[model samples]
Target: MGSRVMPQGAQDISDPFIERHLVIDTSKVNRNAERGGFTNREQNGVTDQVSSPRRSEIVNRSLSAVKSFGNDDIDLEGGDVEKDRDKTIRGSRIVKVRNQAVLSGLAYCISSCSMILINKFVLSSYNFNAGISLMLYQNLVSVIIVSILSLSGVISTEPLTWRLIRVWLPVNFIFVGMLITSMFSLKYINVAMVTVLKNVTNVITALGEMYLFKKHHENRVWAALFLMIVSAISGGITDLSFHAVGYSWQIINCFLTASYSLTLRRVMDTAKQVTKSGNLNEFSMVLLNNTLSLPLGVLLIFVFNEVDYLSTTPLLRMPMFWLVITASGFLGLAISFTSMWFLHETGATTYSLVGSLNKIPLSVAGILLFNVPTSLQNFASILFGLLAGVFFAKAKMREKSQS
Candidate 1:
């Protein structure tokens, strides 16, 4: 009677059915290895064998379930097996994500530092004092590259609308100001010294975060900020050739630079709403940023009286000049692409930290490549400054951890 008749719903709880849906959590496998998954086997000098009672109990239950299901003429797709496989796939995906993030950060650092050095060479060595003209040309190059990619369907971006452009205008203004002042500052400042001085941007950004967002910094953060200030002052005074105009422009750049990063965060949400694709991708931001800068760049070119120089300059006719500037333009685009890639993969904090970490090598390269005059004291100050940057990055990361 027991074999021939069954209660209602008894089939639902049968071994076959249970085996198909039963999922055993293997998450404890690693934990059990520490204290539970070992057995003594001194006869063969195998002190640790995988014959522990806990492990045997789990294996026996799983095998018994499979055998009972088989006896019942049922095949189990194996819920526990599926789960374990899924867990393995998820673990690999997590590793892949981290690897990509590290690669992105590295690429961003290389492009950013190299772009600065190349631009400095073009402006200083090539005798191109027309910083705005260079910026205009570089931005135009970025626009063209992005356009070609979009047209070829290798990439996609949103169409321009006045409503969208208007929402982005404020951020664009700050961006233009940052770029122009960067050019102005780089013109007269040595690359190493420029990097050291630019540390002030962090201070300005922190102040903006505190005042605007009402976020407070820890004491360690404040101390790091103080070190940055001292380094900046000492590095400034020890400079072999200090340009007042350059320093002033860089100071302005600090504020604008900080403002760009902070404002970009606030505007990103709104910028996404108006895009033709209704998605704000890196290419779209690149397109919008470089495109908007063009008109303003033209105005600045006129305001700075570079048009006359552009018309008469023999460098404009030189193929080598074109080649170098074109390369710089490509590098400029690379910087934008990589910067966005890194920011996207790693978030703002890691992006900022990697940037700060990159300044040391960039500074050393600048001094060596450009043959900038430096004394022991000045070099020490730059070192101190770079270390201060490292400290600040750590402080920010720590504060983030605690919060």
Candidate 2:
């Protein structure tokens, strides 16, 4: 077809394509222009296209074909935009996960350190003699808080049926013994020394795992364990205010702690068997242990002759003492929840690593806060033990990854 040129400033309405082939829908376009979706420059371009057509219909048809084929598929800028959008989404998700893990780790460290300090204060500072009673009170607080949470639907917990209780009873006894001995040891031993001595539990647990679960460890793990033993012995020998009773209690506590760990692993399988869902969660285990400990704790209190001590102790009369003890109880519950959360958010290896490294700051805090008497030799031993713990965790992690 031949084309004709129009006069300057004259509007061309030759084709009238929309009016002839399709119904016109200018209302929505006009509304959009009024709403700013179509800017003044865009509106002027439309007016120019109607008044003075610069390109032919053949060029317009080619542009329409390019648009229909998808500009993003062929254009490098569009591809780059898509990649940037995807990167932004993935980066946001990574940031969220990292934030959660860091928060959970901090919570675990604070609650664990605070719980130990509170117990030490009550036992040594306040001169409280009733270890079993203290444990009982803490467990009672846990039960009360957990029950309230369960009732309010803030958390879920498995029901404490008779079968579940029976399965958990053995582990509960070991758990009680562990807590009582730990409390007793903290009465005389300084927190730093106590933390160093706790490395023994890891060694015992490793040995127990080998024998009972048929698990084997790498040479580095054994080497780390040996370093732990050496550090503990050196720390003890150099301790200026070493108490025979405290060391004895801590040795017993270590064995009990190892037993509790090994026993709990077996008990978990049995516990799950009793549940209808065949799943046992961390909160359920927390509730079970604390709930079952109450009766055993009460029995132990009488057996330990702490009832008379509690009756005569004037510290109980102090509101500040009561407040500190109550806070310890809450911190105990917090430890359980935070530890579980941290382990879930990260992994077992990261949890152990953080736990081992946590003792460094905790030991320093303990020494500074309580004015604990210590020699340079003993302090060196403490640092050695802390490093050994970190090495042990890394060794275990490496061993796990290899297997």
- Candidate 2 local lDDT, 196-310, one digit each (tens): 8888877888888899999998999999999999999999999988999999998998888777666766776778899977876656767777778888888888888989988
Total backbone collisions for each predicted model: 0, 0
Please write out the lDDT profile of model 1 over residues 263-381, one tens digit for every residue.
76687778778776666665676788788989998999999999999999899999999988888777766765665566556555565566667888889989999899999989999
Which regions in candidate 1 have their CA more than 4 angstroms from the true location?
A: 1-106, 276-278, 340-350
Q: What is the lDDT of residue 247 in candidate 1?
A: 96
List TM-scores for all candidates, in order: 0.74, 0.80
RMSD of each: 17.5, 21.9
